[model samples]
Target: MLSIQNLHKTYGAQVLFDGASLQMTPGERLGLVGRNGHGKSTLFRLVLGEEDADSGIISLPRNYRIGHLAQHLHFTQPTVLEEACLGLPEGEEWDHYKAERILFGLGFVEEDMAKAPSTFSGGFQIRLNLAKVLVSNPNLLLLDEPTNYLDILSIRWITKFLRAWKNELIIISHDWEFMDSVTTHTAAIHRHKIIKLSGGTEKLYAQIAQDEEIHEKTRVNEEKKRKQVEVFISRFRAKASKASSVQSRVKQLEKMGEKEKLSRIANLDFAFHYAPIPAKRLMEVHNLSFHFDPHKPLIHNFNFTIHAGDRIAVIGKNGYGKSTLLNLMAGELNPLHGTVRSHPDLELGYFGQTNIDRLHKGQTVEQEIASANGALNRTAVRTLCGIMMFSGDNAEKKVGVLSGGERSRVLLGKILAAPANLLFLDEPTNHLDMQSIESLVEAIEDFEGAVVIVTHSEMILRAVATRLVLFQHGNAEVFNGGYDYFLEKVGWEEEGKQHR
Candidate 1:
């Protein structure tokens, strides 16, 4: 029930949208795909009237109500329950159960319902806004990275929640599995155009590739014909008898249309530098116990072992000792009780959200990547920069001027350039798009060493996790099986009852 007609948007030297158009059928679920700065969110703002397009028609009915997860937070109510209930539509304010079901699914406890909204953390505050948007029941729901703040349990809850959605939805997410699971169609922003298709992302991407391939072949054939004409004209020009023929060829060459060669798109393509070792046992954890309070232990008397070629995923609800354990394993934090023993030749590379702050703001992207691995020479450094999609002069961009996504890429480039037998990553997909996350999946799959990550994406977990460090029921424990086995045998405990 929504349509964008011949959109043309630009900002100075950068062209965000050029004659881009998309149509959404009523009750359609669309998964929007594009690079980070390719105008996915800009299109959202254009539809919402927050930003004006240079020239376009974004047509929707007068009664259409749009719901989005607001970045700004201004809670009029003090209690969490009351603040959430504020999302109830007019003449239905008494239906607080709708809000409670959403709040509970979003990880709010019974006790938390009475707590002040201001007392919650920034991430949880964002979730509160999300709950409001979800409960509002708008005609068109636009969610951009709703899973960024969610834990594995909450993500599962939202997945189920959105699958039952009857209204229109346009979601932009790096978690392909989630988007593919819920969406009926896939749409992408490619070459300044919106390509919409039925079925999933794989099908849509294959169609795009086939179209581009045909375009390239046509361009090549036209170039060959033009070259042949030019060569015929040049070779026969000196002969008096061939003068008329050469003139005709010249006329033909002049009439031939010129086609611009398509530049190769930059994509994240690189493998992590693996440092192989003969030893099987990489690290051992003995009676690991850690806590911020003496009365409550988050990880208590936990024991686990890390081996070479291991893919261990630490998973649970947010604030439930996932990242804490990752930090402890990476040696960023010390355990309160127990020993985390490592092999003598253990080499580590870590990608964490907090690590972004450690980057030198004054240094360039190339400088930061090279600093991670001192043995890498200038050529290797530039190659790594190119692998990160920072080509030519963009490699010299100062870290201070980079966006959050760019900074995350620099952090990953550092990890890839270094020699690491063991990797510790926490929410590595937070600042990445679909393409970059797919590249990350390949890098993890191709790496010869071990990897341990904390992520909310079931897609990545199912792909890489051979072992799991599960935090559930107020205890952190290790599960010997993969994510599929865990989901089949031991699903998320304490999740709210399915409302659908």
Candidate 2:
């Protein structure tokens, strides 16, 4: 459907691509992979003609219709239904039906259809944007982080939808599982070029690992040969018997040194500092019920207790009281009808979207960590900052100038540094890349204290959660068989109805 050849793009001194080429055809779902700020979006812009490549050609069919999801939705329509129905064809009945079908599949109810789009949360508004794009039914789809704020149920629905989509697609996402389940081809941006591989995202990761292993072996062999040559040169360069051989060896060493190039690897050693597990139950909740409006209760008759060594995942659809429950537990929200009791020795570290606001704008990353825990020395704070991908000079940058994702990392770093036996995290993986998420999972697995996390990431949930807290119909249900059992018993079964 589209072709890119010799795509050269640069921003001043930084070169994003050099002769990168890729081709897309019908029935190919392409997953574009690259580090942040590495020109994946630049390639998209080149394809969309939003930015001119330094020098290259991006060829597209004449009058090809492309449906691209916007990073933000700008709604002028009065109602959510009206915004979703923006691009439908002439048939009024079928148009409305199709719009509603897409919206409902994405977790919007009939009641929500009549509400103003402005009233919906940012996540819900993004779903509306997705609905608009789907209703357009274009020839090619360009989705950038389409599952950014989606719940697990909505993510499953979108995955199933894209899995069955017949046309061409190119998606950029940090969700590896989502890409693996939906895409047929993997396109990786590496070494200033695009490497297209058969199969999915997992195959791309395997290929990268294999290539790194091969590169390591080659480097080792080359280094061994260079050392032997250097030793021979050093031992015989003074003697006339081996002078000519020594000169040749010197030239060979220079050539080897010039040709050597190390494989690029991301910094993935992120680890959360551990805390001592408390001897007592971390927290206890009894008959917890909360509601923003008196007429409709979001949480009703909820009771749960969190103990030391507990790794719990809170999950549900949007507006189903998952976040509210977390807030209630964290004491951010007062319960309408119950008590949240905590052990006197329980030290808590809470991480949520709003935690970013708690960070002092004047503070640097290292300073933030030190301020969080007075016991941590300068070296320890710097080490923690480096583990969070802020090393040396980057660690000295002020929090005010950092990106949203960077600020999120800073808050997480603070939470990790805090001497907290009980941790509360809501959507902690939302802003993290796959590598960072993997590191986070490892850290969570290694944590000795109690953790209560609200996330849609199956990887994190399966790896870190020993129990599942599910929100359903204004009540909470506890599942003791972990995340896999939750998927088997409740996750897939409930969302699969829309697919059928």
Candidate 3:
């Protein structure tokens, strides 16, 4: 168990947390939720003692063990398994056995155990980091965005593992379903304060909103009563002895009257405008096959046709060719065996998770969007940037100085401004806030183009996708309905029945 008391942290003039306090019990699974840049990660750092808070007291039992899985890490070990097994507690053969079992559960095979983690892809490295944290077997586990780079299957694995975990856990993640599956408590940071609720994450959020609504109603009724009492006293004060009782009642009302402070809810609405309608056939792929190596095929004989105003989602485990499929669709890579055809007038916009690495270091936000599309005027560019939450001086900041979320927003802004009839988005919502994701879903729903999105977010998929393309076991299957229908037909419950 751990407790934080009167915690305060500030960066320059910006206050992150003020008097935030929370208590955790053994085996408690807490889901930490907040908007981006609201110091969720900073709270984790404070608990881990990685950074000194401005003022606070973090208390835990003496000799209590802690494990933290950060967003990024560097491994120097010669093999992935070696790196994952480092720093595990000794003196218990069962602990070693558990470590190996965890590594295997995380998708490391016997052959992969001998290969260096440095040679693995970014997604693989992320899984390796998770394995490292799980092997430590600490009493409390702190996971920050643990599923950001993982695919659906790996996320399911983590969800199941955490559901069965017996120790305390504090997780910060954007995956709502995963949090609901694993956590029984919710801790939210908003406006420099922490709000704790007992329940699953979704239930907690709903309860908070319901409580706020009830508070607002109570406040309204109290104000009305106070006004009525005041009016009665004012109208009757000089009338006579008959109104003397009313005056006394007014004094009693004043004594009991207090205004409730209501928290302000920020409103964010995003809209996209489309040009004149186009033909129904947005893109058509025929017998498309791609291979990074000549002998190993990544996507084999892939064929799909996307029509205008269709929202299609691609789902798969990591390293199962989701990004590669997007690349082929975007014309960034050539198909090895077949042809990808698009409408003559179709303009394409591509958004990849790693697109930030391609940004020019010296380019400002203004320059990047301008360079992406030549005809945008200054005012139009600024308007586009504003929709993505970059305003005024932020538009002048260099791309190199922006945070990960900022960079992602800028890239998405550029994509939005382009005259694209077909959009290919690969993990586009990874670094985005929930508000931003909702805005994006709204934008996609309103856009008059075909969208092929590769993401693991069930919320987004269910909201925007009309069709599901599930990739598993080295093949793709086209399912005719939305994410919910796909889940029902695939029998996902059967896959987790044994574990449950």
Off by over 4 Å in 3: 70-78, 93-97, 207-268, 370-376, 487-500
Who wins the lDDT comparison? 1
Candidate 3 residue-wise lDDT, 88-138, digit = tens? 776653454565667666666668888988888887787888888887878
lDDT winner, 1 or 3 = 1
Whole-model lDDT, candidate 1?
A: 0.90
What lDDT score belongs to each candidate, Candidate 1 first?
0.90, 0.83, 0.80
Candidates 1 and 3 compared by TM-score, better number: 1
Tens digit per residue, CA lDDT, model 1, 1-500: 88999999988988888999999998999999988998899889999999999998999988999999998989999899999888888887999999999998998989999999999998999999999999999999999989998988888889999999999999999888899999999999887789999888889999999988888899899999998998898899999999999999988888887877877777888788988777899999899899988787899988999999999999998888888998888788899999899898899999988899999999999999999889989999999899898989999999999988999999999998878899998888887988899999998999999999998899999999999999997888889999999878887777534422
* lDDT of candidate model 3 versus the reference: 0.80
Q: Report how far off residue 140 is in candidate 3 (Å).
A: 0.7
Clashes of 3: 0
lDDT over C-alpha atoms for residue 393 of model 2:
98
Error of 3 at 61 (Å): 1.0
Model 2: number of clashes? 0
- Screening candidate 1 with a backbone cut-off below 3 angstroms (N, C-alpha, C), the clashing residue pairs are none
